[model samples]
Target: MVANTQMDADKVKIMGSKVKVDSIMKVADIEEAEKQKMKRKVDKILAYKPDVFINRQLVYNYPEQLLADAGVMVIEHADFDGMERLAAVLGAEILSTFDDPKSDVLGSCAGIEEIMIGEDKVIKFAGCQRNEACSIVLRGSGNHILDEAERSLHDAICVLVSAVKNHRTIYGGGNAEIRMSLAVHDLANTVEGKQALAIEAFSRALRQ
Candidate 1:
């Protein structure tokens, strides 16, 4: 049984990594849940738990979906119409959140891999990969974020994407990889700026 702690981390790593998720998740369904809990949401969940538990089903009375697969963030089918959705969603963050641009970015994103539900498809989630010091001002090589909403959106995409892109460094299923979908230097301080950013992002997704 995988812990919920791996949820968020797995999401980003998978989406960013370059691998085949459908084949991997098709084989490993259970581990996918475990990855999501530990990678993305456990720490946040534990804060409410006060004490951890056996599976993602918390012993404490907290939002169960917080650990369930439904809560995991993911983007689907990056090869087709998915890229546009991913671009705005993944690149929604700005420089303040470390979504900045750099020449040394080995890969646009950094994260793990896993699978998803409803369909027999695996995915790779990306955007703002995990780091010891996870924030906007990470090293030259770092995934970034801009705001809380963007972070949440990022997590959602990570879940779906991660299952697609498995780790190449490993044997069958490894970490995933993703690239910057969009780049916004100055986020709108005014209500319109914020709205514009969102509109632009989704618009780009529609275009793709």
Candidate 2:
């Protein structure tokens, strides 16, 4: 994933808080510098030969066209949190700088595409590492509804991830609690004295 700041070539300014400085450069020189920086970033990304490029900020036409020409899918405006989630889902590393992107940092996906669901357009990544990636398209009548839906989906995903990592299952309707209570009760029966009474009480609480 390529997530870098895209500097505006037309907007060049020098400002400092504790110190003052004066510097001038030709417009062509400034623009050329920006283009060079962008080219370096693109080259670093292309070195990995990634199947998809996820940009944290909106990519200008130049970089977008460059990646497209190289036959790589591009996802623009993916915020920091979204990028982190994608990295986790794809089992990839987020390299702050592309100086040395080792083989371990690269991620793979079967394919990526832009799909329209309802009134919204979303990019979908398929066949991610361990099939861990998923995308949900929310449809709502208002902003409030959409916000609520997003929050709900986030909570659900958190629970799902926890369950997957733990590799433990517990049934609903208090069935697991009942089973625990029964096991504790059996253990209490095997013991003797006041400690047994305490264990019995604990098991009873679990039943409640």
Candidate 3:
């Protein structure tokens, strides 16, 4: 996926690193040759009969058009992290070559479709092999609002994860503070010294 597919060959051996074309006719011939090579590469891919193809690198116009014409959804320039996670979620491997693609090496999902979200096109994958695979889409009128929402959501998720791992629970929304303050006040009443004054001060600070 991470190759310049528009080039004549994915791995080219330069005979003399500095060859110059003589005229416009030569340039045209070279371009035509590269186009034909790309056509062959695309044809090889079409023979696999894939419903969708995702590339971590660019898929230029020519090959992109060829795949589209063959009714294959081509998604190019996929982010590396997302691609890695997707491979794990779908129980598939990240392949460098398609010389011999097998059914077991391919990923599958129930469906993939494009949806519009706040003026942007987004691809949605449904019914993934991993039941835990999911996505959260946040929409807002402004970027700041969306950023704040994302931060809050991330914090909430972290809290839930911590609770699951630690198996601990505590009151939220200032209730814990009030309870601590009351407990500290009760302890201060049992003592008689400047330490009690300090404890009362600490409890008062927690109330504030």
Candidate 4:
């Protein structure tokens, strides 16, 4: 199954510049589990995908496409801003006895597919609403880029799937939609080479 969502700037203004979104999902091990249960789970997700994408991403992120989809969108322009969202996915299938087990799951990018926009201006975002807080990196320091990207990637309706709140992933990450904000690169401590340019870009992006 697949889902698409988008958000744009104008709608953002009317709906308010900021939209609040928070979710929780439960992931269970399907190993040794029955067939009917698995079918039910898949059906549940496909059903809710549309509702969440429309109601949530639409009012928030405000991408040029105006709808935030599972795939990604890369727009090109001189006045470009960069946004990367890291979503946490739960991998385990069966084993539902535990409401919230200390297990790990797989994650997917909220921008499931990549959709290009504009011949010059580009904006991108990613999300992980399954079992982890996706990491979204905003480039160019565009004004509130982090918040903008986060809002764009909040697409999944049932993806806030919860594993043990503090459960670690197979790669040593947590299982929650934790939002961490940062610039294209770290410049606070390092001022070498093009650090000045990077900083300038960040500053302009922040103010722009």
> Highest TM-score among the candidates is held by which one?
3
Error of 2 at 94 (Å): 1.9
Q: Put the candidates in lDDT order, highest first.
A: 3, 2, 1, 4
- Top candidate (lDDT): 3
Q: Runs in model 2 with CA error above 4 Å?
A: 2-25, 136-208
lDDT of 3 by residue, 58-89 (tens): 77778888889999888887777788777766
Error of 1 at 75 (Å): 13
Kindly give the stretch of ten consecutive residues in candidate 3 with the minimal lDDT sum.
Answer: 1-10
RMSD values, in order shown: 27.0, 7.6, 6.1, 26.0
lDDT of 1 by residue, 152-196 (tens): 767986865676686433323321111112333123223384687
> Candidate 1 or 2, higher TM-score?
2
Worst 10 residues of 1 by lDDT: 172-181
The alpha-carbon deviation from the true structure for residue 168 of candidate 4, after best TM-score superposition, in angstroms, is 38
The TM-score obtained by model 1 is 0.17
**Judged by lDDT against the true structure, how good is candidate 2?**
0.75
Please, what is the TM-score per model?
Answer: 0.17, 0.59, 0.62, 0.16
Ranking by TM-score: 3, 2, 1, 4
Query: Which stretch of 10 consecutive residues in model 4 shows the poorest summed lDDT?
Result: 78-87
Which lDDT tens digits does candidate 2 get at residues 1-208? 6454552322344566342335444555766677777777777878888767776777777777777889877777777877877887777886657777677787777777788887767777788885555556788999999999999989998998899899887779999899999999999999999999999999999999
Colliding residue pairs in candidate 2: none
